[model samples]
Target: MSTDSTSLKLKKEIEEAADFLPLLGTDYIELYVGNAKQSALYYQAAWGFQPLAFSGLETGNKQSASYVLVQDKIRLVLTSPLKEGGPINRHIDKHGDGVKVVALWVDDARKSYQETVKRGARSYMEPKSIEDENGEVVLSGIHTYGETVHVFVERKNYHGAFMPGFKPWNPAYQPEGTGLKYIDHMVGNVGWNEMGKWCEFYAHVMGFAQLVSFDDKDISTDYTALMSKVMSNGNGRIKFPINEPAEGKKKSQIEEYIEFYNGAGVQHVALATDNIIETVKKLQQRGVEFLKVPSTYYDTVLDRVGQIDEDLEPLKELGILIDRDDEGYLLQLFTKPVLDRPTMFFEIIQRKGAKSFGKGNFKALFEAIEREQKLRGTL
Candidate 1:
């Protein structure tokens, strides 16, 4: 087969795997920020991410700022600029607040690095070691997007809950956690004509394969549309869905993201919890505000989608939305813009049995976003 034909065939097989995405779980999500402390507080108080580790003035790593937060199975590292001129600062100035690293957990960092590089991947960093009382940790990285990277983490040598220096936070003000267990999927919005390029990068460079695809025709509305392709590793644990907006009567959400972000970058990080109602409630009390959906949405949810295993009352109370597909049902909710710029956000999701992105709810969810855009004068 021709090279392009071979790739297309491989992509088709990958997407059809469905529940077989082989990802172990999320290692850590690193965000480049202007202020690590403030962002840390925002996550802890609003999102219920607990203080898991710290490194900075207090820890003697003063070159840059860092904070580590954790939930049941998720770890988030917040890094910021300590100097006026630095790469982190440049990224923030260009792209606003967004994910810089989507680290993956592995048994052997060195091998993962060697294998991917041998497969035509461009190296971002060589495998290196960080030591502490728990043990040693090895890590490596590969470039993904404009200023975005995927890091390989080998923690077999460590025994701590998170990386070293992060003490178990017993903060009195910590927000209670929602049942979010791990990262379900992370979606990125790229510039026009960039989706296929990135998808190819994942396929040839990182050994990932495209799993599912949606063109503007599938995802677009009369006013707006975008194309997307989901790529995943052999183990479905890690999924990266790339998107690019198509011309529309009004600005689509992908277009808005590219505009505010100033280039191609992550649009949202969808974190998966086990119990969304508990998670969202804790998130709300802690200060995280979700995109407002009317209470009336719950009125016809059951009638429209049929019965789910979860109680409808609590879901309605928390403004969590549900949808179904031939595969199964999934519940999810979105947070309002999480950064100063209207760029990046978070999604709290609970997957009962469904493996698909909430396609059934995209219309409702996008309309909810449109409401927010109208208020911000961006619609």
Candidate 2:
């Protein structure tokens, strides 16, 4: 077959899949960390996440401590084991403050679990209900790539601070939000040649369709290369772009992640903001470090992305990257690794009608990452 015809056929087949287990939106992302209290404080002070709820010994029957933080529609749960030698502790030891749960808000947890489990998903948690004076919530989970799991949270009947066993955390140190709205998407880095396997899992088990795909030629620097595929559910509320290392002269970022993380894991969480310039200013003032591309990057950026709404001066000053797709353009910046290991980070993004990831900026972005890896002696 001719290459052009083959491309058209593949594009035609990449339509949205059927929605079996409807997902409302992201419920909360829970991270297994070493110290939930200190981490909570860090997020509050640095990222402007307000303390929303707390679960620990005070809540009674506690094996672990959890601090829930919220900013707009985004909710983050930081958890730490109160005692040693448990699964949480083991996860911490293995991954070192990485994401463990990507919870999806659903209307019926039982049906969600059953649909996925019957479709060949490995069960992580059986559907169970937890209740308090406020209401009741049903939660079910299934294992995904690495130690990470997707939890189906049915909270239509709950209305308390968070859920059962967590009280409202009204601390005096609530910082003003930085205009971060909600999770735009999350990226996962897998081992070599495993991206397609996990993409298939999302396709068959969760009813997600492949939105886009990138090869090594599309996302590569002078020394590193990787392949990626973007997957999205029926409603397009949740998007996951799975990445795997490709052959290159030096180590790619995916290789470095798997080496330090010891397995496949969540690479970064991209948070959406309405105002990129102001939000980046607040985050920088609050001491969140971001990757820097050369000033030369801005010299010809506009020539590539064409006219944008924001002034170029502040965006260049703040070191934010800009990319344009067929739909529209997006402004985004990547933070350095938030934890000790260079595993997980955050991507602050502002999409101005763009429905695609930043494919136009992949070369410059990967070059910046290669510089960081050189400093860490990992590349």
Return the top candidate by lDDT.
Answer: 2
Residue range 1-379, candidate 2, lDDT tens digits: 0011122122222357766777767889999999999999999999999999999999894699999999999999999998879899999898899999999988789999999999999999999999998889899999999999999988877889899989999989989999999999999999988998999999999999999999999999889999999998877888999999999999999999999999999999999999989998999999999999999999999999999998999999999999999889999999999988989999999999888899988999999999999999999
lDDT of 2 at 262: 91
What lDDT score is found at residue 216 in candidate 2? 94
lDDT of 1 by residue, 271-299 (tens): 88777888788878767889867877888
Lowest-sum lDDT 10-residue window in model 1: 1-10
TM-score of decoy 2: 0.96
Give the CA lDDT, 0 to 100, for residue 79 in model 1: 89
Question: Scored by Cα lDDT, where does model 1 land?
Answer: 0.78
RMSD of 2: 6.8
Model 1, 138: alpha-carbon shift in Å? Answer: 1.2
